[model samples]
Target: MITVVTNVDLFSTFQHVLQPLTLKPLQVVLAYSGGLDSHVLLHLLARYQHLYPQHAYLAVHVHHGLSDNADAWLGHCQQTAAALGINFIAEKVVLNVGRRESLEAQARTARYQAIAKHLNNGSLLLLGQHLDDQLETFLLQLKRGAGVKGLSAMAAQMPFSLQENCLIVRPLLTHPQQMLVDYASQAQLSWVEDESNNDQSYDRNFLRHQIIPSLKLRWPGIAHAVHRSAELCAEQQALADEIAEIDVVTCAHSFSGLNIAGLAKLSKIRRNNVMRFWLAAQYLPMPSRHHLDKVWLEVVNAADDANPQLRWQAGEFRRYQGVLYNQQQYAALKDVVITLEHTLSQRITLPDNIGTLHLQDLIQDTIHNKSGVDSSNAIGDNDSGCCVKAPLAHDKVTIRFRGEGTCHPVGRSGSRSIKKLYQEYQVAPWLRDRIPLIYYGEALVCAVGLWVCKGYEAQAGLYWHVTRER
Candidate 1:
């Protein structure tokens, strides 16, 4: 058992010092599992909410539905939240702890994913992991032989770029488990002990029960020391990021995907860092060290004309026609076309553009900020609707597969081939095939948002619309 401290001054941490500059007036969601650590965190957040009423607070409990007592634990969590006068939400998710993933890691990923659903565009998701957890993570990274980034471990606060927007803030990284237990006892808060946590079958458990304790007995402050080492590594990582940003700009070209020619000029270490930075920017899974070596040999050393390809778990990368493209393989669009028979007067959302469709929905006041409007025509009084036809379904509107075509943009007198247009607009080849084209049953109405034919002009009073996005 770990020795406990009676009191914890939560406000003295590095985070509190940086709170003025860092903290946003956003919702704070805690991944509460009714476990010792999360329970302590939930209590701290409750206290924090009382202090800062401007920021919203919520406790999310994810029910994996794995344990027999899952429902009972959820009930306990609900009661605890009610007693604390904090909003509580629960989510149930299925976890398949297959051969590749341990039950602990699988459950962790699912639980956090569920908690992330409660977050909004500017919210903060706080986690309860402590110093010991950081040490374990460091050991795991070492076992996998990860480089500097992995060794840096988790950041104290970092923006999490999920579809459900928020930043994942780890405020408890500086604290140890004993400090949390001490705080819980002093605060008289009750929390459940997960039986699975003690099971030696899990790798983390084995490390916690068998290895860490033995190591701790020899060096009492091992976890803290390791935590310090991780901090230093983290600082080094920030420096690396600074250097990488500069290198990336120098070695990159807007036209040729990632300038493989420019990348070849840097030393091997700088080359690897630049590659990793670019991959991170694209959100592709970082390739293994060996894979990076392979890519370097292929991209930098191979003949300029050679097309090289590298693939990993998340996505694939290919070089073609002096431009390298990274793509996530997806199913091809169905050959079928679906049409809406709604009247033009009715506000109808087109099939593909989920965000925007009709002209009325467009922000009139914000029109000045937007570019690429047909400027030569009237002083923007009537936004072009393409054709002034009476409210009728007579216009053969169908979503068609992108095919070889010639486009005569509204202002341009002559037509240009699709391939040439793509080049002129600097649209990547992968994006060209992905752009949706609306067809008037053989005649291309518009390249969605790209360009509309000069022949099809929207006059003052009729109804027509088109939209597109990157």
Candidate 2:
């Protein structure tokens, strides 16, 4: 068994993956579950630790807090790590297995989140999934009727920006489960067995126990053949990615929305492909086939003046003001206001959603300060002299919402309605009400985020400063 392990040194195989990615001074974090496969990996890693002193490594076991033996298993992992002279980290995570989300998806999400927290740039998270597991994943993708990218299954070395600079390397992807088990038995390695593996409740387990066995007996090389199919899918995906990059460059607009005319110019097949590719790039989940088909029809077939709107769990897409806008729900804010006295500066923390402000100039001394400066001492002859000085008075500050307001910008005496001002500015109707208008009691001093009221406009030889949290 030692000879077999020596001959198939997983460490050296991993090295080739690392050098190309420059994933070194390597910090290899194995997602150790105390199960047979990961246990074998931990054992192998410990064996080669001395040879790779420059590489930092650890065994991370995520205790899902699901199974009853979770505590015991965590303890076992700690003991094993201590005995083997390798560092061990255990994360106790709450699993949110909802009715809509499967046990497999929930567990994978929680486990990856836990591991990701520990990884920094240039580090790698290793999973114990072998060739058989890859074969199962490929079959599952087919069951869902996934596209080429999904059928590509897992990559040998995946670089994830979990932190500023990090990469995840799966060295065991090419190795078969049988080979790992054989090596473990030959070397007399002890590992915990998860009873869930035998539970047919899980789809992957059902496939492994019932479907794969029958298929393998008939084909004898089903796993290897399916694995090859996944590789071919991955190669096709590379070509698709190149083409998608070209499409993205052509159709993407200034506001990160799609250019409707440019998109319409593409061939129907390419349009659909590029739309799916664009949504996926934005981390938006794909809609159903029928929904996508509808989307294409609404965008391409509809009259130019037709108002097109579509929604999905990920987000909504609407054709408005000549641009295709993909939108998400924004955080809302409480209506509040703070009033600042003339010649006084104030620092105000804004609510999550209330950011913009509508304003009116009230007094001759009132000044609008757009200077990006924090509250400071008021110098009588300093810039922002028309507004309050820094070290603002505490008592008079107040916050209020924009209701009816009117203001004449500098060089103009006639007041324009706040509603008309916003329209002229082209502020989206969805965003206009959310902008907070700052008031010093009854008087509007400055807008929380947007322009300060023209009356309170900061000017040279004036003594006022305004501070806001971005």
Whole-model Cα lDDT per candidate? 0.68, 0.67
lDDT of 1 by residue, 97-189 (tens): 565766777887787678767788877777888888998888888888888788888778787766345677788887878888777887788
After TM-score superposition, the amount by which residue 14's alpha carbon in candidate 1 deviates from its true location, in angstroms, is 10
Worst 10 residues of 2 by lDDT: 355-364
Error of 1 at 246 (Å): 2.5
Error of 1 at 364 (Å): 4.1
Where does model 2 exceed 4 Å of error? Answer: 1-11, 19-26, 298-308, 333-470
Return the TM-score for each candidate structure: 0.77, 0.72
Supply the global lDDT for candidate 2. Answer: 0.67
Top model number, lDDT:
1
Q: What TM value does model 2 have?
A: 0.72
Error of 2 at 303 (Å): 6.7
Q: Looking at model 1, report the run of 10 residues with the lowest lDDT sum.
A: 357-366
